[model samples]
Target: MIVAIKYPNGQPYHDSTHQPLSKKAADSKPVQHGHRGMSLEQELNRANEFYLQRGIANIHKKPTPIQIVHVDYPKRAAAKITEAYFQQASTTDYNGIYQGHYLDFDAKETNSPTAFPLNNLHQHQVTHLLDTKRLGGISFLIIRFTKYQETYCVPIDAINQFWERRKTERQSIPYQAIVQHGVLIQPSLYPSLPYLEAVDHII
Candidate 1:
């Protein structure tokens, strides 16, 4: 069974081996839930903005292209988009430059405790990330375990390996594998997810 561990005062609640510590022995407060209601997209947007303000990195979310089919305009009012459909998005969610390296990644959140379902990712996304990696760009997936309020930055190479193993393996990547191979990130007040720090270790 999965037991949620709360980290108060931004301290690491887990041991070096990532085993959750006993709550009774640790003097800590409860996990704050103020930002829990926000969606992952909103969190990334805020984090990107934080990065930009600090002049540390310049990253932005890719806007989804919409094919507007119909629009109604009133003489004294603004036009309203009536009908529209999404154009196929080619690349990952966010891409930009950081420390002279091209960065590309997709953000995902899962509620599952045992494993992360492969179905959450698309074949096109995998191909895009692989191509980016081949081109010498840093590519990865930012996965958040929403249930545990834990987040990790997993390299594209690791993802590619599991992605290829799907042919003969299970449809999901086990959580233990992720913890072993992925970089765990502590959420911060600014640059919220602070994923780039994990990237620092990777590169």
Candidate 2:
């Protein structure tokens, strides 16, 4: 989604002119509900860093390419970037090489007791993963059942099936189905999530 200069808080601005958040959907930040007590992003970043360091996998978070509209050039040596906006994300959250295979996937956490909401994914992302899978790439979604404290590695094809027929099926993958078909990823230290272990077992 293209956005103008906006802070992490979702506050808006037009060239540093603060606009009133009158009717904006400014919801409070959601708490991280996982074993390691870290946000999903933080844990994945730490895992990626650890994997890169040990030369295990080169997975990395895809940065949201942004267009800088304005900058405060207080000094020539170091320009203070004051205003910038993010363009729409075209692919999944994380992508890289792992054990001679291409990896493309996204991570999501749900507090619901039974089913994981399919709306966590976008149409473009589903299409991207399907395309990658067609080329023999490893694609999946790392979903955390926060309240249950269990993580499941659901294959991209399964997600694709649901997404493509979502209009007709209109169904969410329940916890029971996840356990039946999903690969369980046990938690660990250092990398915190140790999802690679599960991937290894599956592949």
Candidate 3:
């Protein structure tokens, strides 16, 4: 079967293949232990589900808009997406209503223990968040530092401050600064990462 995927700008997607490590090599590698058992997205999804079930908030991940170019049907009952293209660049990871205010945010994770790379966010996304904030909506970022197993709800103001500083100084936001300005979201059993608890502080 052949499959092709392209970005909205018409650039073809390239899948980078990685070789699997042998058993011995995999076992030999040092594993960093942390309380987080799931990725940032998964944790948030679980949290959103919890919120939804309890009638707390109606938050959800935004689905990427895509156009199917081709479909392959080898059997009558089996069909495969053979070709597709993204309709446009996504604005954010998630958006919905919470506590009578519109919520818009993106989930981001960094391996770096000291800082978050500014380049991780695109200009379009920044613009979208800023625009949302200007219109009296809640806009923020959910950032996770894998090494520390810590997640934070960083407000748009903090992002704007560091974003402007990047042009004149460093290319990343210092971990300490984020810790000072952002609210730490603790992981829980039912909701997983209880980020809205942090959002409560933000609003």
Strongest candidate by lDDT: 3
Identify the runs in model 3 with alpha carbons over 4 angstroms from their true place. Answer: 1-35, 72-79, 86-88
Q: Estimate each model's TM-score.
A: 0.80, 0.78, 0.78
Over 1-203, each residue of candidate 2 has an lDDT whose tens digit, in order, gives 77566465544554421221122221343233334557777777767776776789999898888999888765333455678988988889899999999988899989988988788778888888889889998888888888988888888887776677777886577778777767998876445678888787656
How well is each residue in 104-133 modelled by candidate 3, as lDDT tens digits? 999899999999999998888888999999
Q: Model 1: what TM-score?
A: 0.80
**Model 1 Cα lDDT, one tens digit per residue, 1-203:** 86545465434355442222234422365355435576777777767766776688999999997899999985654566789999988889899999999999999989998888999999989999989989989999988888887788899889878889887988888888888888998776543567788889776
Query: Lowest lDDT 10-mer window, candidate 2?
Result: 17-26
| Candidate with more favorable, higher lDDT: 2 or 3 | 3
Superposed by TM-score, candidate 1 places the C-alpha of residue 183 at a distance from the truth, in angstroms, of 0.7
lDDT of 3 at 136: 94
Backbone clashes in model 2: 0
Question: What's model 3's lDDT at 43?
Answer: 72
State in Å the error of residue 26, model 2: 40
* Best prediction by TM-score: 1
